[model samples]
Target chain A: MSEVYAARRERLRERCAASGSATALVSRPANVRYLAGAAPRGAVLLLGRGTDLMVCAGPLGAHPDDDRPDEALRIQTLPGAADGRGDPAVAAADLAVADGAESLAVEEHHLTVARHRAIRSVTPRLRLTDLGGAVEQLRVIKDEEEISCLRIGAEIADQALSELLESILVGRTERHLALELERRLVDHGADGPAFATSVGTGPNSGRRGHRPTDRRVEEGDFLSVCLGATYRGYRCEIGRTFVIGTSPADWQIELYDLVFAAQRAGREALIPGAEYRDVDRAARQVLDSAGYGHGLSPLTGHGVGLEIDEDPQLAPAAMGKLDTCVPVTVEPGVHLPGRGGVRIDDTLVVRPEADGGPELLTITTKELLAL
Target chain B: MSEVYAARRERLRERCAASGSATALVSRPANVRYLAGAAPRGAVLLLGRGTDLMVCAGPLGAHPDDDRPDEALRIQTLPGAADGRGDPAVAAADLAVADGAESLAVEEHHLTVARHRAIRSVTPRLRLTDLGGAVEQLRVIKDEEEISCLRIGAEIADQALSELLESILVGRTERHLALELERRLVDHGADGPAFATSVGTGPNSGRRGHRPTDRRVEEGDFLSVCLGATYRGYRCEIGRTFVIGTSPADWQIELYDLVFAAQRAGREALIPGAEYRDVDRAARQVLDSAGYGHGLSPLTGHGVGLEIDEDPQLAPAAMGKLDTCVPVTVEPGVHLPGRGGVRIDDTLVVRPEADGGPELLTITTKELLAL
Candidate 1:
């Protein structure tokens, strides 16, 4: 495990060196964790110096869940700086310059302008460069160990959703249902919900990323739920829409079937060599032809990893090809303004045809059930 | 209500004009909400232009909890930009430059380097100046209406904590307790927990800002819980420690009393015109004299409002003085490593001697109860 982190840091160092930077400071929490194996909040990893240092503001206490840094790397605790209060990025930059690094690359997309300016002021002689999305690109493809975490997270999400289905959901507010799902996710061994558990019902149904509200579940209304779990820092999403009564209305059934078909098409298009935009188009065209494309979500789906949303976005303007072992969500939904709507989503990993088509991690049935 | 937001924006405009900035863009979500009365995610409020516009990425959906923008302010929804996806800061900058604003101010401390660069590229001729926490300064002395929201939020938090005290707590894990508290917060009319609820048990107890873990409660263990609720965009925090068994150990009782005294001192120091450092000192001196100051937390407490952690931090190096109506938490804790510890926190509003030294919002008792 330690070697894995060391190798990741080596790869990042190679990338930085190729870009003419002698040192790279990873301030983004996820990026720091990817390279250092553990990212205590406000901890930063400075690479390419004689010894890769994980600069933290204070001692990592009895935090069982905090990722442990690679044992081989040196850890520097800045006691003068208050625990969890000072900016570790600025401290890391000062250390990098003091360690004789001439050029340092930082994530411009993550660091605020004020912090970046502070870094420049502290190291007037050191040249600063942008390390734009380089680490994010590296995180796109996952190893089997990473995939197993995702698989476990998906299973937890599935168990939670299944339990919600078995219980009484009628007359429950969207907020309560969402909270229950989150609690169930934790009960089933997830760190927490990968993101806010979204439970949209009645007029709120089928909306992409709709925040749970106080609206109650009612008969003949569409009830859509989207939730995910975080296991060992990996995240996976699953969304399903169900009718609230004994039988669905004609419009509800039609909307559910249309979304299911779009989601299936999107899932089927997840081949290793497929373009991201093409996969998005495969699902989006189904809804477009059905005349519900005008207010469609910006993206059909998005990549998921340590972060709930990452790269390789499945959108019309996305520029990239799907790679093997890249986990992504293929969610498509259509919501009519005053009426209800439908959404079906699943997390799957892109795989070669020789092994299998896209390997579905979130296997919760998409069948529109009348609860 | 609309006039209140308009008046706030006018005050900001005056501040920016004094600083030689003809126009100002508020990209920080809390600041945007403060000035515009609503901050749809990814929205920005541009002041000093003929019409102060709340530029949002898309139409505000049927989100009842979302703050309604001041009626006097015109809302410009860019339908082309996906909901909550586009950078309204860049759009606002483009608008400002096109409207012939020669100079514009922005919250450099909040904007990322990439975003600041994007704004510069889009408006090359516009002189970008640092807003420099001006809005935050304005927010420091909150109005009575804002204080009322905090008061309600504190009441909700107190209710949630009281309910938890009645439940059995001999064997529950910290994570479950934290989640239950959050569920209860929503049940009591909170939009949500202001921040992640912290429930540290036994050795993990009394740690400031400790993330909840899976450690279960045991007899004689110290249990510390910190939680808050967000009501109408205002947030408040309250923390307390209790003994798990019917009787506490001698050491536990002493630690609890010492922490209680310290917390009381800090709370009592929250009068108007009190230096922030003096307030912190009032708390620190109590624990320091008892030989437990070596590993004390950085700050005694901090302000809470639209955001859980805000300005006027009560730390040794802080430079501000408390003003009337400024609500802040005076939390003091001592963690003894392998053994447990105690923390007492309360949110109170500073007041003058004529009106009452300070107003306590959270009414949760400070008595160290042995459950």
Candidate 2:
């Protein structure tokens, strides 16, 4: 495990050196956690000229969840950072200059302008360069170990959703149901919900990222739920739409079938070397041809990993190809204002056609069940 | 309500004019919400030459929680922003240039370097100035309505904590307890938990902002829980520690008593016009004199409002004076590594001596109850 982190840092260092930077500062929490085994709050990883250092505001040991740094790497705690005076990134840049590094690469997208200015003021001679999304790019493809975490997270989410299906959902407020799903996820051994559990009912159904409200579940209404779980830092997402009555309305059935077919098309497009946009179009065209494309969500799906949302977005304008071992969600939905809609989503890993194709991690049936 | 937002924007406009920036762009969500009465995701407020405008990625009405913009303000949605191509801040800057504003002020502390650069590239002639923490300063003193929201949120938190005290808790894990508390808060009509609820047991007890873990309660362990609720966009915090068994160990009783005294002193120091550092010192001195100051947390407390952690942090090096109606938490805790510790926190509003002193919002007793 320690060697895995060290190898990742070495890869980042080689990339920085290739880009003419002798040092790279990783302040983004996820990126820091990727290079170093752990990322304590306000902690930054500085790949210096001679050695890599994890600069933290306080002792990392105090945080139980933050993974300890690889023994090969050094840890430095600023004297007053615990009192909020010290910034780990600035301290890392100062260390980079002290180590005789001429150029430092930082994630300009993550660090605020003021923090960047502070870094420049502290090291006037050191040239600052943009690290950009190099770490995020590296995180796109996952090893089997990473996939295992996602699989477990998906299982936890599936279990939670299954339990919710068995309970009496009618008359329950969207807020309570969402909370119950989250609790069940934790009960089934998840760190927490990957993101907020979205439970949209009635007119709120099929809305992407809809926050749970006090609206109660009612007969003949569309009930859509989108939730995920985080297990050991890896996140997986799953969404399904169901009917709340004994028999669904004609529009509800039609919308559910259309969304299910679209989601299936999107999921089936998850082959290695497929263009991200093509995969999105596979699902999008189904909905577009059905005349529900005007207010469709931006993307059919997106890559997921340590972060709930990551790289390789499946959208019309997205510029990337799916690779083997990349985990992504294939969610497609259509919502009509004042009426409900449907969305079916799943997390799967891309694989070569010869190898059994995509491995579906979230296996909850999307049959539009009527309770 | 709309007039209040317009008045807040007017005050910001006056400040920007005084600072020589003809136009101000507010991108920080809380500041935008404060000035515009709504802050949809990826939205930026531009106090343009002609009128203040909110630029968002999607229709603001689609989001249920986002407050409607003041009727006097205009709203513009970029064509491709919903699909992730457009950035509201950059578009606002471009609009500022088009509106004939020679100079623009932005929240440099909130904007990323890449974003600031993009804004500059799009509007090369516009002189970009730092808005600094001007909006945050304006938000430091809450109006009566804002204070009322915090008061209600505190009452909800107290209700949730009281309910938890009556439940069986001999062997429950920290995570379950935290989740239960959050569910209860929502049951009591909170929009949601202000922040992640913290529940630490035994050795994990009394750590500030400690993430709940799988550790279960034991016979003589110290249990500490910290939670808050957000009501109508206002947030408040409360924390308390209790003994697990019928009788606490001699050391546990002594430590709990000392922490209670320190917390009481901190609460007593929340009078109007008090220096922020003095409030922190009042709490620190109690624990410091008892030889437990070596590993104390950075700050004694901090202000809470729209965001859980906001302005007016009460720390040793903090420079500010508390004003009337400023809601803050005086949370002082001591963690003794393997032995566990105690923390007592409450949200209170500062008031003049003539007005009967500070108003305590979280009314849960400080007494150490053996559950």
Candidate 3:
């Protein structure tokens, strides 16, 4: 694992060298974690020129030695770290200047203008270049270890959802159900929820990213839940909509079938060489022709890993093609204003045609389930 | 309430005008919320040049109407909002340009370099000026209404913590306890926890922002728990340390008293006209004299409101002063590396001596309990 992180840093270093940067500072947490193995609170990764350094303000967040960075990376806790006052990015810049580096590349997309100005003020003589989405691009494809973590996270999410289905759900508030799902996710060995658990019932169902409310579930109401787990550092998402009564109504079944088909289309389109937009269109078109075009979310689904939303967004405007080992979510839904709707989502890894195709990670059933 | 939001926006608009800007864009969520009752997901508040607009990507997060922005602020959901595709800030900048504004002030501290660059690209003719924490400065002194929310939130937190103390805690893991406390916070009507709940046991106790571990509670161990609740967008924090089982070691009692005294000093120093650093020094000097000076967190406490950690940081180097209605936490602790330590924290609102000194919001007992 240490070697893996070191190699990752080495690759980034090579990229920086080719880009005319003497050093590179990764201020983005996920990018730092990708190259350093673990990112402590306010930690930043400095790559290039001398020895690689992971400068942290203090100890790691919540979990300590359990998520230690690569052994190969030199951990530099800022002086007076007891107060946790230092910005690791500025410290990295100071180290760069002290090491006599000429230029440093930084993530312009991540660092705020104020922090960027502070960094420049710290190293007035050094030329700071834009690292852009270099690390994000590097993280698009994953190794087996990364995929395994995502798989575990998906399994945890599935377990949490499965447990929710077994027990009584009607008459329960959306907020309570969301909280229960989150607790279950943690119980099943997740660091925490990949994101806030979304539970919508009745009128709120099928709404994308709907915040759980105190609205209680009632008979004949559609219950839509979107949840994910963070295993180790990787994240995966799974969403399912079920009816609250003994049997789903005609509209509920029809809506569920439409959304399930759209989701399946998006999932099936996740081939290694599939264009990101093409995959989105595969799912989007299913609902578009059915007169539900105006009610769709921007994207059909999005890539997930370290962060729940990553690169290779499966949206109409998204560019680039899928690559093997690239994990993404294929979610599609349609919501009516007054009445409820349906959404079926799944996380899958893009695989080649010869290797069976896209590997579905979130294996929760899409078939309409009635509580 | 709508008038209150309008007045806040007017104040900010005047500040921007005084700074020689035609319009101001608030991209920071808290600042937006402060000015516009509720800030929807990916929303930005554009003040001045014309009617204030709260441009949002889509609907409000989770709860819609319950947390809607001020009615006076016109909300413009982006054209393709169904997919949540638009960046509200960029749309805001475009609005500024369309409104014939010659200069636009933006929160440079909140906007990323890439985002700032994108805004410049969109409106090259418009002079882009740095707003630079103008809204945050305005938010420093809370209104009676804002303080009321904080008071309610504090009550919720105190209730949650008090409930946790009554439950049997021995043999329970720090993570489970932390989760349980969070659930209780929600059960007691908190929108959610203000921040991640911190539960430390044994050697982990007394550490600032300690992440809960699987370590179980045992006899003769020091236990520190820090939790907060978010109610009506206001947040409050409270932390207390207790000795596990029916007895405590001499070192534990001694450390707990020291932290308690330091915390009290800090709370007492929260007068309306006191310097922020002086309030910190009040708590810090106590621990400093006890040979635990070097191990203190950057600040003895910090102001809390819409965000858990806000401005008016009570740190040694922080430049600010306590003002009436400003809510802050006075937390102080000492940690023994191998053995458990103690931390005591409370949230209080600064008031004039005439108003009966500092108004403590968290009313939980500070005395060490052997639970």
Candidate 4:
């Protein structure tokens, strides 16, 4: 694991050196974790031009039970960070200057303008440059270990969703169900829910990123839930819609089938070399032709890994192409104003045709179920 | 409530006008919520030089059940935010330019360098100026309505903590305890947790911001838990320490008593004109006299409002004086290297001596209980 993290840091160093920066700072939590194996809250990774270091705001190994920062890197702690006055990024910049680095690259998208100015003031002689999304691009293709973590996370999410299906859901509010699913995820060995669990009932169903409300599930209503689990820091998502009662209304069944088909098309299009927008189109065109395109969500799905949402976005106007081992989600849905809606989503890894195509990580049955 | 939000926005506008800016953009979610009533996720508030607007990425009234964006303010939605493609800040900047504003003030501490640059590029002729902590400073003093919400949030948090104390704890893990506490917070009608619940046992006990783990309660363990509830967006925090078994060891009792005294001293120092550092010193000196000050957290207490941690931080180096109606948490703790430790935290509001001194929002008993 340490070697893997070291290799990642080495690659980042090469990118920085090529861009005329011998050293780089990673303040984004996910980016720091990707190169440092683990990052304590408020920790930053200062890479190259010195001993690779993970500078933490608090004590080293704050969560020692699960924290396993790369053994190959040294750790430094700011004296008063836990009190909220210390900033690891500024301290890391000072360290960069002490290491004799002439220039340092940083993630301009992550650091606030105030922090950037402070860093500049702390190390006025050290030239600062934008590292852009270099680390994010490097993370697009996952190693086998990373994929295994995502696979486990997906399995946990599937177990949690399936268990919710077997239980009595009617009369229970969306907020309660969301909380139950989160507890189940943890019981199944997940670090936590990858994101806030969304359980929408009736009119609220099928809305993307819908925050769970107190509206209780009722008979003849559509219930949509989107949840994920984080296993070993890898996140995977699965969303499904179901009928509240035994028999679904005609409109509910129709909407569910349409969303299911669209989601399937998006998943099936997750082949290596496929353009991101093409995959989005595969799912989007299904809904567009069906006349439900007016309020369709922006993207069919998005890449999921260390962060629930990542690069290789399967959206219209997206420029990137998918690659093998890149895990992404395929979610598509539509909602009627006063009625309900349906959303079917799954996590899958892009794979070559020789490897039997995209590997589905979340195997929860998407068939519209009447519970 | 709408009038309250309108007045807050007017005050911010006056500040911006005095700073040579005709308009201001608030991107920080809490600050936006403070000025715009209820801001949607990824929403920004554009104030002055035109009609006050809350520019959101999603649909209008996404969470109509509880969302109450100021009725006096206009709501605008970016067409592609739910698809994860829209940036409310950039759109707000464009609106500022369209409003004929020659200069705009933005929260530089919250906006990323990339985003700040994007806003600059979008409206090059519109001079961008730093709003700094103008909004945060405005938020330090609470109105009667704001204090009422915080009072309710503190009550909910206290109920949750007391309920947990009555449950069987010998075999429970810290993670389970944390989850149960959060569930209770929601059950009691909280919007959600103010922050991540922290439950630490044995060697992990009393560490500020300790992430829960799977360690089960042991007979002689010192168990510490810190949790908060969010009621209508007002956040309040409470923390307590207990011995897992029927009787505590001498060291556990001593440490618990010391922390309790420290917390009490800090809480008692919350006067209308008290210097922030004086409150911190009132707590720090107790721990320092007992030789436990070496690793004490930087700030003994800090102001709380829409955001859990806010301005007027009660720290040694914090520059400010406490004003009446400013709610803050006085949390003091000690983390022993190998054994365990103790922390006692409570939320209180500063008041004049004529008004019965400080108002204790969290009335949970600070006694060290043996569960």
Candidate 5:
């Protein structure tokens, strides 16, 4: 594992050298974790011309899930800096200059203007270049190990959701339901939820990133929930909408069927070389033709890995094509104001036709379940 | 409530006018929420010359926990824009210029250089000045209503921590304990945890912000737990440590005594008009004189309200004075390498000595409990 991280850093070093940068400072937490194997809070990794240093402000505590750094990387805890204070990015720049490096590349997007100014002030003679989203672009595709983590996370989410279905949920509040699902996720060995557990009920259901409220679930309410689990820093998502009673009404079944068909179309479109927009269109056109176009969310689904929402966004204006080994979610929903709606989401990995097209990670049944 | 938001915006307008800037762009989420009552994802509040507009890339849906915006402020949701594309800060600047504002103040510390350049390009006729934590400074010394929220959040945290202490915690993993505590926080009416829950056992105890792991509790292990709850947007913190066996060892007793004494001294020092450094020294010197100087966390405590860690930081070199009604956490701990340690933390409001200085919000017992 240490060798993998070191090799990734070496590849990044090679790219920087080709660009004429003497050194590189990785400030973004995910990127730092990708190349350094560990990302302690307020820690920065400096890929100097000779040695690599992980400068941290706080104690080098270990997370239960992630990989620890190998012995090759030097870990230096800075003096006098507290947890969440004293920008480590500036310290990296200062270290670069002290090492006699003439040029440095920083992640301009993540560093604020004030911190950038401070870095420049400390090393006035050093030339700074934009690293842009180089690390993010590097992380678009995943190794088999990374995919394994996401796969397990998806399974945990599936188990949690399935358990919630078997239990009685009609009278519970959205907040309690969300909390219970989160607890179940942990019980199933997930490090935590990929993001905040979203539980939207009735008119609130099927909304993107809906926060749970104290509103009780009524008999005819549309209870839509979107949740995911994080396993070893990798995240996967699953969303489903259900009716609160023994039998869903005609309108409820119709809405659920519409969303289910749209979600199926999106999943079917996930091929090795399919364009991201094409996948989105497969899902979005169904809802749009049904006259639910105006209030649609920006994206149908997004790539999921280290970050819950990553690149390869499935939207109308999004560019780029899906590749084998890339994991993504295809979620589509339509919400009718005053009334309610349905949302169905699943996490899948893009694969070749020879490999059964897309590998569905979240294997929960799409059939609407009534509590 | 709407009038209060409007009045806060009016005060900010007055400040901008005196600085010779006719408008201000608030890009920071907390700042936007402070003035506009609600800040949707990727939303920016523009205090225009004639009107205020929340510039967002999409329609503002109902957020789960945050308060909705006042009807007085106009919401301008952009159409056809890609999700997560187009900076709202730049859009706010363009709106300000279109509204015929001559100058604009931007949060330089929050906005990136790329967005700053785009803002400059869109409004070439306008002069941009640094807003520079101006909104954060305004947020300092919160109103009575805001303090009430913090008080309630503190109570929720207290309830969660107390419940965890009564459970059979001798053999549970640190990760499970942390998750259970967070679930209880929501059960007690917190929107969610103010921050991630931390549970440390054995050598990991007493460390500030220690991430919970899979380590199971053992006999004679010193178990320390820190947790918080966020009510509305107000956040408060509480931390306590306990002995695992029937009775604590002599080392555990001594360490707990030292930390308790330091935390009390820090709370007593939180008088109105007292220097921030004085309050930190009141607690820090106790730990320093005990020959545990080098490894202590930099700041004894920090202000807590809408944000867990806000202004009025109590540190050795920190500048500024403690103002009345500014709630803060006075947490001080020492961790031994091989042997475990103790950490005691609480939330208290700064008050005048004549009026019973420092109102404690976290009422959990500080005694070394043997579970």
Candidate 6:
């Protein structure tokens, strides 16, 4: 694990050196964790001329549940412990300047304007440059260990969803169902829900990011649930839409079939070199030709890893192509105003046709189940 | 309720006008919610020259659990549906400049350097000024309506804790306990958990922000739990320490008593006009004099409102005077290296001595109970 983190840092160092920066400062927690084995809250990773240090805001004492900092890197916790005073990013910049590093690269997108100004104030002579999404791009293709974590996370999500289906859920409220699913996810050894568990029922079903509510599951309403689990630091998402009662209405069946087919098309388009926009179009064109394009969400799918939403966005305006090991979600949905709607989502890793095509992480039945 | 949001916006307008800016842009979600009644994710509130518009990346769709936006205010979903392309703050600034406003005040601390540069690039003639923590200062002394929400949230938290106490807890993991508490919080009408629930057992106990893990309870172990509930957007927190066995060891009792005394002293110091450092010292000095100061947490308490952790931080270095109606959490804990320790926390509102001193929002029992 330590070697893996060190190798990741070395790769980031190469990117920084290519950009004329001798030091790289990672302040984003996920980025820091990606480069450093583990990042304590408020920890910043400074890869400088002297030594790599993970600067933290609080005491370095261990908490039972905390991910221990990699022993290969030095750990530094600041004094005074006041908020906004002892920023780790500034500490990193100062350390780099003291170590005689001429140029430092920082994630300008992650650090706030005030923090950026503070870093400049601390190291007046050190040249500051943007690292941009270099760390994010480096994280796009997962190593085997990273993929294993995502795989476990997806399995945990599946188990939680499966258990929810076996229970009597007709009279339960969306909030209760969501909470129960989250509890089951943890019971199945997940770190926690990858994001807030969303259970949308009735008129609220199929809406993207729809929060759970008190509305009870009715006999003829659409029931859509989107949930995920975090294993280690990796996250995977899965969404499914079902109908209430023993039989689905004609509209419900059509909407469910359309979304399921669209989501399947999006997942199938996940080739090693496919353009991101092409995958989005594969999913979106199906909905568009079906006259459900105007109110569609901006993107059909997105990359999921340490954060529920990451790079390699499958959107019409998105640039870049899917890499072989890139894991992304292919979620497509259509919501009809007061009548509810349908959404089908799955997490899959892009693979070449020679390697048996896209590898599906979340294996849950997407058939229109009238429960 | 709409009138309250309108009045809050009016106050901000007055401040901007006095500072020579005709309009203000609020980008922080909590700040937006403070002035616009409810904040949608990625929503920005613009106090235009002639009118106020709440700009969002998408339509003002309802969340399943969270509160809906106050319908009185005008809303504008951006022309393009893509999130990366639309900048509500910049759009608000452009609207102000187009409406013949010469200057715009924006939350500099909240806005990123890139976003600031982009706004400047688009509206070259418009003078941009910093609105540093002005809205936060305005939020310090909450109104009676806000207090009522906190009070209800506190009740929900109290109910959740009480229910947990009645359940069997000899062998449950910390993660399961935390999840159960959160489920109960929702069962009692919380919008959600105020923050991630913290449950620590044995060696993990008494740590601030301890992420719950798979540590099962054992006899003679110290168990510390910190939890809260958010009602309507107002958040209140409460933490308590307990002994797992029938009777606590002599050391556990002594530690719990010392921490309780320190917490009580801190609560007594929360009078209107009390110095923030003095309140922290009132809590700190007790633990310091008792020879348990080396591993104390950085702060004693902090203000809680629309956000769980907000302004008016009560720390040794914090410079501010507490005012009436300011809600804060005084959480003081001692974490021993090898053995677990104790932490006691509560949410209280600062009030005048004549008004019966500090009003406790979270009325959970602080007694050292041996479960």
TM-score of the A chain in candidate 4: the value is: 0.97
Q: Per candidate, chain B TM-score?
A: 0.97, 0.98, 0.97, 0.97, 0.97, 0.97
**Residue A126, candidate 4: alpha-carbon lDDT:** 88
| TM-score (C-alpha) between model 6 and the true structure | 0.98
- The RMSD of every model to the true structure, in order and in angstroms, is 1.4, 1.2, 1.9, 1.5, 2.1, 1.5
Instruction: Note the residue pairs that clash in candidate 3.
Output: A62-B211, A83-B298, A211-B62, A297-B83, A298-B83
Q: Write the per-residue lDDT of candidate 4 for residues A10-57, one digit (tens) a residue.
A: 999998888889999999999999999887888999997769998988
Write down the TM-score of every candidate. Answer: 0.98, 0.99, 0.97, 0.98, 0.96, 0.98
User: Candidate 6, residue A327: CA error in Å?
Assistant: 0.6
After superposition, the stretches of candidate 2 with alpha carbons farther than 4 Å from their true spots are: A63-66, B63-66
How many residue pairs clash in all the candidates, one count each?
A: 0, 0, 5, 0, 0, 0
Model 6 segments beyond 4 Å from truth?
Answer: B62-66
The reply for model 1, stretches above 4 Å from the true place, is: A83-86, B83-86
C-alpha lDDT score of every prediction, in listed order: 0.90, 0.91, 0.88, 0.90, 0.87, 0.89
- Candidate 4, what DockQ? 0.74
Give the per-residue lDDT of model 5 (tens digit) for B143-252: 88998999999999999988888789888998899989998999899989999999999978887888787889999999999999999888999999899999888888
Tens-digit lDDT track of model 1 for B125-170: 9999999999999999999999999999999999999999999998
What is the Cα-based lDDT of residue B370 in candidate 1? Answer: 84
Q: How do the residues A197-297 of candidate 1 rate in per-residue lDDT, one tens digit apiece?
A: 99999888888878888888988889999999999888899999999889788888888889999999999999988999999999999999999989888
Q: Could you tell which candidate, 3 or 4, scores higher by TM-score?
A: 4
Chain A of candidate 1 gets a TM-score of: 0.98
Q: Which regions of candidate 4 are displaced past 4 Å?
A: A84-86, B81-86
Instruction: Name the candidate that leads on lDDT.
Output: 2
| Runs of candidate 3 exceeding 4 Å displacement | A59-66, A81-86, B59-66, B81-86
**Per-residue lDDT tens digits of candidate 5, residues A203-293?**
8888878888888888988899999999988999999998888878898998898899899999999998899999999999999898888
Residue B283 in candidate 4 has what lDDT?
94
DockQ of 2: 0.75
Give one digit per residue, the lDDT tens place, for model 6 in A256-298.
8898889988988999889999999999999999999988989
Error of 5 at B330 (Å): 0.7
